[model samples]
Target: MQDQGLARRELIAAGLAGAAVALPPVALAQSGARAPDAPRSAPAAVRAHRVEVPMPHGGVAAGHPLAAMAGTRMLLQGGSAADAAVAAMAVMNVVEPWASSAAGNGFATCLDRKAGTVHSLAFTGGAPGLFDPAVDPAELDSGHKAVTVPGAFGGWIALARRFGRLPLSRLLEPAIGYARDGHPLDASIAMFIRRQQAVLARYPTSAAIFLPGGQPPAPRALFRNLPLARTLQGLADAEASALQAGADRDKALMAAHAHFYTGPVAQEMTRFSQANGGWLRMADMAAYAPLWEAPVSTGYRGLDVYCSPLTSRTGLELCEQLNIVEGWDLSSIAAGDPQLAHCLIEAIKVAKADIYRHAGDPRIVTVPVDMLLSKAFAAKRRAIIDLARAIAFPRGADIARAGDPSLLALADDRSRGGDTTSLSVVDADGNAIAVTTTVGGGFGTSVVMGDTGLLCNNGLRIGSTAPYDGHPNRAAPGKRALLGNGPVIVLDKGRLKLVCGTPGGETIGQTQFQFLVNVIDRGMPIQEAIEAPRFALQADPSFYKAGAAISVQMESRFAPAITQGLSAMGHRLEMVSPFAIGSIQGVLVDGSGARMGGSDPRRMGYAVGY
Candidate 1:
């Protein structure tokens, strides 16, 4: 393909020295078989600017500013990465409720630097096990199902208890202070409140807090959560007591768990779920447990990547998608080549073919993980792509064993709303945590718990039903819901290289895929890579108002001629904004060993590294 020296030099410059970044052996061997097609382009350079911060022997925190600042504060206080992440998550619960809340769940993948092991913590909650699936779908959409056994609290506590150097009480102080005394609302929050005021007004509890006097608060209005502060303090007290367990060990731990799900707040949640047709039980709250397991993974250019387990399908799908593409030349595809997009999209389609058919909760479905990520299977999957024609099918070819009924159901999620939030923290000890949390939509279920300062999640409603076929994400009792929030960690040469994740319903996977390609293939910095205009392709029709939402910039360039061409080849298309396509955040270590990072500029995001 090219002189070895030049390739080696480029790899070294890109920080891939002494690394076995094995491309698909076939792709490498076929480099000289034929010249690749040229990429589509606009006359003007599409400016994808990014803000990169550098920290020397310090830390970097990203997502919301208040959350980032809180994490930084923790790091400065000599807390571990886990401590900082727990603090940041708490603040995000208070300030960025549009994205997530303590009432929902989260999954974090952390690296124990000293042990050189990757540990994954899934805080994702499940439906009350004893609940009946035959409950009215409408009621299930209401207040009762809203009360999940909040896994975020337990998950955070577990992380801190396992890896933190600071006391939980100290780690929680920043969020508690913000919630108690109040903090000025940022412009983004204010604007969102004004725009969604009518929608928010539907929920009395939310309307009272988010919209005072039945109107959205003015910009910079002080937002306070006295109840949340009390809840946080109660948790702090519980953690402090539990950490010092003794003769009354079980008693204190039980008290800590009780105060939220089964204590005074329990009545409010129980009443709401019963009225709303939810199936939550006091027993569900007390018995729910967060799972700690090794993350699902695959290698990319010598990097050992880790993602959440199959409780949710994101991790398996991630590996499957990458496996299919590993046999293709990503660099040729990303270096301004339309064929690259076509090929990558095709490969993704093939991987998803298997994902929809088999990927799901391992306890419920028997998935062929080995077959999906195998290089040989990838070659078989890749053979389906035709560079000249789009493979128009209901879904990709099934590369693995198929299950009986499709699990995904098309619930009326338009009402539940979906917005995802994510955070990343790297400590002085080199342990890193990347957590992606969501409430399944903005102000999930639009039903706030009375005076609890908690918004219930409609995670159950995410599953698909009959008319939509037996999709892998259908609603069911005790089944973990499908998620587009894929938090991931990448290790290079046994050292952590990147910790990152993103939001955007189903677009999360496509966004992560493109961002990874931007960095590892196009030679872009982490920020520029993530900020680049992105696109996605899922076999599902739901994501599209009318087919896929293509970028306006791309629309203007392609016109009817290109559309007709792709359409003739079978790709349905719609127009959308480039920025709205997806947003991502991540941290990377440069060849010089400097830790640099970036957040999406299109969002109200800030990345700080000292």
Candidate 2:
């Protein structure tokens, strides 16, 4: 027993020594500045639970530690940013099933370090071909009818074919392992599960997987999803078989795509939906294809900001907000200054008004993209902002006169809840990817596919349910939803500067915009930029029930003086939790080839580097 005790002590000593050695120089210096017996790592965790990792070779920041590590593993295997992103996303689907899933949809921005070009991949879910527009909005918001034709699998295959160096099977191995062997449920996930117990209980399959004993799992409990693992393994096996059958890279990818969208998987999904009275069909699955397009870009100061175009209204909204704020010298404004917050809030209101008025699926509507992105248009909209007073743009005002009021109201009433995940990665070769994914509402209809363990998305809930004639966003066959996802890449002089994104539904664009200002204008580090208190404008009337008043939601961490100042400026103020806004993950790679990764302390996210 004495020998065993001595060995345990030795092991602990060795671990401490290893941790000390692995500490960054800055961390070591800070440790030295404190008392010798004082805990160095403990205080760091208590203060912010994050550090700006300077990755000389590669880095990844994701919503969960396991997901980030999976991406790092891919980078270590000499994979491109695209490969790492796919690996991370797959792991996220298993670990963060409450927020995202393989059955969900997403958007990605990949930056080619060599070519200095940014590409936008739009895998946003679309309505099934036989979608029932007359269904109750409440029904579409949850349950089987809410499921759209998933695009994430096809998206992964496409990204791999375009830029990955490793096989799709290898990229997905980490996620498959985690799902099979089980991972310890973290505090964040545990809390989410507990909160969602009632909702999850409505579906037997979901309850069986998430609540094994009719209760939420405690933190650190081992959680496994063998069915999900098998599903992923089957996909990997299919991809391998296609490659071995003399299929070229693209052909192999297409074969794998066919396996998911046009083969047995599609048949199973169609059968399940039909049995459950859902809307998905074999034709919808076969017709689905993820779109790849050049990212919409606008110059902000000296840096060029790029975002997903068309179906995602966030890009134009972000550009217009930035343009309006560009005329002001935000650098001179203090970080928590109320006037600065007011300006940002007002700018968002103006931008959202334009988004509601015009933004939609480009295939079905003339989005007037150029006009909305124009500096002249921004200036005209900027003139309408009453900085001293809060403004509430009535919902459906522009479309009301153009369409049936009842239909317009139904379409405008659809608002997405903030339930999504994000990741940002930068490889050794300077390639980067920023990705945002969601399953629509949290827990995503709370229904799991029988035996498959796939939690289908309720993405259709975010789409316009009203069948208004000529309305761009009205529910239609094969129409992509108007998503708020805004994965971003920032470039300066044709060189990559930053890759960042967040998952906050309506708050996605606003949070990203604030991050840019904090970093570029305030000269803060990536970690500091994310940790800073933020204000969100709840001015869009469409986001609330009828007669709900517009107000500004501010983090309690902001100075009372600032809140008071905003109140004096005629803005309604509502104090919220310190970390209640968006959880942003990002990486900044500078000209010197130094990459720093940042993860939000608001959630159980982490950043890893080498």
Candidate 3:
């Protein structure tokens, strides 16, 4: 205990207080060794009643600790995993607004222990049936493109009905109270709003809700959103009514759902989108529904990895990159062998080639599944990597390919923003859920809604502008836009090992790949994986733009020898700060009824388990 206290103080003095505070729960026993006057009940023993997991390694859990505590509180209170996740999402909307909101859609994957099955939910907005692609570019970039029907509500309900043990109303209780009673401004939240103060001021309703005093809320100041509270309460009541036996139950739900799409919500949104030259219609909202689909998966060291299949190529590309490296003993590479870096960079490029070519909505592209993952193909692909030089351009292996035909954007676009939030949870019943939600880039086009007190997503602008230019992630209406959010789950011998994901636009997969390697391959703790320096081979469209100058501008930490070696073999080395390469949040459940949670240092997030 004396040593632990001394270490904690050292961390605070070093300004790594968050990391110190988020120490893994399992470590408490070691850290809390007793003193002569100390109580016999150890810290871990006392916490055993709730199994409060801690983030191992180091870092402060960003955001309001209360929100995550409330989620874990629900789990301790006998709520289902889905219920806890929903509670977490609602709380995050208040505490982590730069990352997620009720107005944005979310993706989730869950393992149903009782049913012995895995289910996927795509709470993503779709293109209106009547959307036309020929609209003016400027108009599309402004308001028209940002007006997708928010699909998060439908997504939450779907998961609740299928896997939740508690009623949806119960899940929403904490969020409603916070919205009504008010919350203190958090540092991260205040910083995000202040950064976007000029943009928030553009939307009357957003400004009115978030900046009533014509300024961003100061950290620790009390703030409230009564309208948002009413909306949440109304939804909760409607959910309760739906489960009740009354004609008004159906009517109430219908009204609430309709309000956002074609009813009152639509009326206000339509005015803004139209005024901004957007093409969204009230009908788009009325017709939206979150899709449930089979997840894309691959085996890594016998772990069955599952990911949302359609639209995003993150999962597929990840497998391809891994396949290229699986043939070699990474231990040889990690020993500071220059050849190791060269080979890994080469494998990344090969995998990226496949992403630029065939990864897209399964509805549109025939993803070359078998060929991409074959060991033989991976070996052959690995051969393309030179031991001494980087490949300046991406090249496909001996496999079939496709291209991204949806809307896409380059990083140079002044409109570009890349920030996201991830959340995960599990209940006492052994049900687990992982979710990643975003508004496409930070603050999402910097637009906020009027009546809803919500921030609309600019997800529509995530891909290549030239839809059929052979780019794998071009944007299109009715197509899932090229998303950076990749929520994932890993199972070992049919049991859950890890539930994780990240938010980093093109850097998402790259970060996740390294994090997983650190945990499964290098045996590093989750906190170490998240805080470690990382790198990525930008996907198609991105490399063509950022590739040339990145190596030149990068710092020396990457090693000129490494960059030169990779460049000699065929990689474009882009220097990036080790600041979250991607923000990751997740929970790790061990067999002894012990739960460990971790949040990435790069982003403001928290993981609470009880």
Model 2, C-alpha of 534: deviation from truth (Å) = 0.9
TM-score of 3: 0.81
Candidate 1 Cα errors over 4 Å, as ranges? 1-48, 135-142, 194-199, 240-258, 261-268, 271-277, 394-403, 406-417, 463-473, 538-570
TM-score of each: 0.83, 0.89, 0.81
2 or 3, which is superior by TM-score?
2
In candidate 2, how many Å is residue 153 off? 0.9
Top model by TM-score, which number? Answer: 2
- Residues 1-610 of candidate 1 have per-residue lDDT tens digits of 4422223223333332223454433431213323232121111233345446665645655568888888888889898888888888889888877777777877888889899999888877776775556655565444555445567777776787678777777878988999899998878778877876776787787787788788887777898877778877887787566667652534454455566666756666666656656566666666666778888888876678888776655677777677777777777643444565666566656655566556555656566777766777777777777877776432434544555553234332332335777877787778888888877666666666767777766666533221133545455567666555668888888887888887766666677877777777666777667666665664333331122222212323333555555556656666565466555767887776667767886566667766
lDDT of 2 at 79: 93
Please give the lDDT score at residue 443 for candidate 2: 79
Estimate every model's Cα lDDT from 0 to 1: 0.67, 0.79, 0.62
- Let me know the TM-score candidate 2 reaches against the reference structure: 0.89
* Regions of candidate 3 where Cα sits further than 4 Å from its true position: 1-64, 129-132, 135-144, 243-268, 271-276, 335-343, 373-376, 396-417, 462-473, 538-578, 589-594
lDDT string, candidate 3, 1-610, tens digits: 2343323333332232123244443333332333322443223211011112453321112234666676776777777777777777787776676767777776888888677677788888755555565554454333546555677777776676666666556777888888789888777778878988886787677777778789888988877877777777767765566557453434444545655566666677667766765666666667777788887777877677787665655666677777777777775456344575555556666676666555655665566766766667777777766656665554444353443333233344322445667777766666678787777666765566655656666666534232344444445666555555668888877777777777776676677777777667665555555555566654434442323222322233455676676555544556756363677776654555345667765655566654
| Residue 56 of model 1, lDDT score | 61
Number of colliding residue pairs in model 2 = 0
List all candidate RMSDs to the true structure.
Answer: 9.2, 6.7, 6.8
Q: For candidate 2, give the lDDT of residue 310.
A: 71
